[model samples]
Target chain A: MEVAVSIITGLMILGALYAIHAKDLLSSVIACGIVGYSLVICFLLLKAPDLAIVQIVVDTITLIIMVAVVLDSSREELFLKPDTQGYVTTLTGVFLLAIFLYFFVISVQSLDILGKGSLRMAEQYINGAAQKTGSANLVTGVVFDFRGYDTMGEAVVLVTAVLGVLTILRIKGKK
Target chain B: MKGMTLIVKKTTQLMAGIVFMYGIYVIVHGHLTPGGGFAGGVIIAGSLILVTLAFGSDFLKLVKEEAGTTLIESFATLMFILIAVSGFFFGTRIFFNNFLPKGVVGHLISAGVLPLYNIFVGTEVAASIFIIFLSLIIFKEESAQ
Candidate 1:
């Protein structure tokens, strides 16, 4: 498990770096998709199947939207001439990266091991979910019943996004 | 965009139905399975988008009109709202309260208002995605012309 996690983490970093450095916009999009899919795998390895499924679908839709946007726009080659400003930007980025890495290592070391952390809500959900929601799938019960209002909010957000897209794409004075 | 090669068109024709049916299966069995309305709706939209890619926008004309797609989306959203509001009249007067009887656990018709919510959400999502894809494709075509 540790080996798999380490490999996935390495791949994710490689994908992000490739996405950042790729010259072609389409290739950059594909690299971003690789990073997104690898994170879905990481979610699955962490025993969160629901999250994995949502991530995969959301990733696909995002990739589609990005590709459509890229296709619709003028395909101009992005030229980045290196200068003093570029060097300073690169140095700042590296410094930030180092700081984040330090904090990340500290946070990982401070994390509680599995089965050691407080799980009050998780325990209650596990023990009472079936009887309270009367649904066989605990995840479903929790999402659609226990947290139905949250789901409603999510649905409203989706509707708003669709509406925004429609408004943006609407032809002036045309229904 | 015109239709693709014969092989691609034929393959999509064969696979689209199965993909759509699988999406419905996922939505209906959401309470018993890992997939829910959102996932299943996306899957269904994906299958339709695959057909559109293979056969082009002309194929959409045969299945559903542009205005009809928006209408369906609006109606599904309204249906979702109606279902939620019905809970107030029938049940504990709270919004989104599960009023219908929760049948036997593990059955297809169980889970009170959950399956209904899932169905409405699935419909709304599928219609919305279809509209989005169609509009994007039309925009691309117009810009190209």
Candidate 2:
């Protein structure tokens, strides 16, 4: 299991790097998609089916929208050659990546990443949740029932985001 | 845009419907299933996206009802807010209360207000995403013109 996660994480990092450096905008978007779909696999392997499902669908839609936008405007991404400053920045990025990876390795070795966390706050939800919410899916129960106000706010945020996009992009509006 | 070739078009026609059905399935069975409103709604939007991509801007023009999509989105949101607020006036008079009966867990009709929330939220999300996609197409056309 640890080996599988390490391999997937490596692939995800490679995808991110490729997305940054890809000469074609479309290929960059696809590489971004590889990162997302790989995270979905990571979620599933961690036994979070609900998160995996959400991640998969959202990733596909995002890919579609990005592809459409890229196809409409430009295909080839402009490439810029790096100078001394750019090289320094790249070196710093590599340094940060190594530190993060070291921390991640240490964290993954703990039992929490394997789904046996301390459950300080979640203890209330996991115990007698089915009876309390009367829903087979505890995540949905928490999302739409216990934390319903938060969910409603999220929905409203989505609506507002769409409204903003439409307002900016509308070809015509009311007179 | 004239869209892809006939093979792509035909394949999309056959597959889009099934994908849409699967999205609805996820939304309807939200309480009992792994996925709920937002995820399922994206799948539904994806099916429409497939159709639009396969058929091109001509198809979108044929369905010149972006206003109608906005109306549906507004109505769904209104309904969602109304449902949430209705609890304030119901049995317990508490805001966001589960005023309805919660049947056995894992049942189709269980989870008093979860399914309703899911359906309304699903509709809102699907409309919102489709509208965004539709407007992007129109924006591209307008800018080009």
TM-score on alpha carbons, each prediction: 0.87, 0.88
Candidate 2, A55-124: lDDT as tens digits = 9988988997898789777898777789999999999999999999999898877656555565766888
Which is the leading candidate under TM-score?
Answer: 2
lDDT of 2 by residue, B37-74 (tens): 98898889889888888989875672375688889999
Candidate 1 has a DockQ of 0.57
Q: Please tell me what DockQ candidate 2 reaches.
A: 0.71
RMSD of each: 2.8, 2.8
For residue A156, model 2's alpha carbon misses the true position, in angstroms, by 1.0
Error (Å) of candidate 2 at residue A38 is 0.5
Task: Residues A4-67, candidate 1: write the lDDT tens digits.
Answer: 9889989999989988787788888889999999999888888878678768977897798788
Candidate 1, B1-145: lDDT as tens digits: 6778899999998999998999899889888888888888888888878888889766557225557877877787787788877888984888777888888888888889888888888888887887787877675566566
Candidate 2 stretches with Cα past 4 Å from truth are: A81-114, A171-175
Superposition-based RMSD of candidate 2 using all C-alpha atoms, in angstroms? 2.8
User: Model 1 — TM-score against the truth?
Assistant: 0.87
- Deviation from native of the Cα of residue A78 in model 2, angstroms: 2.0
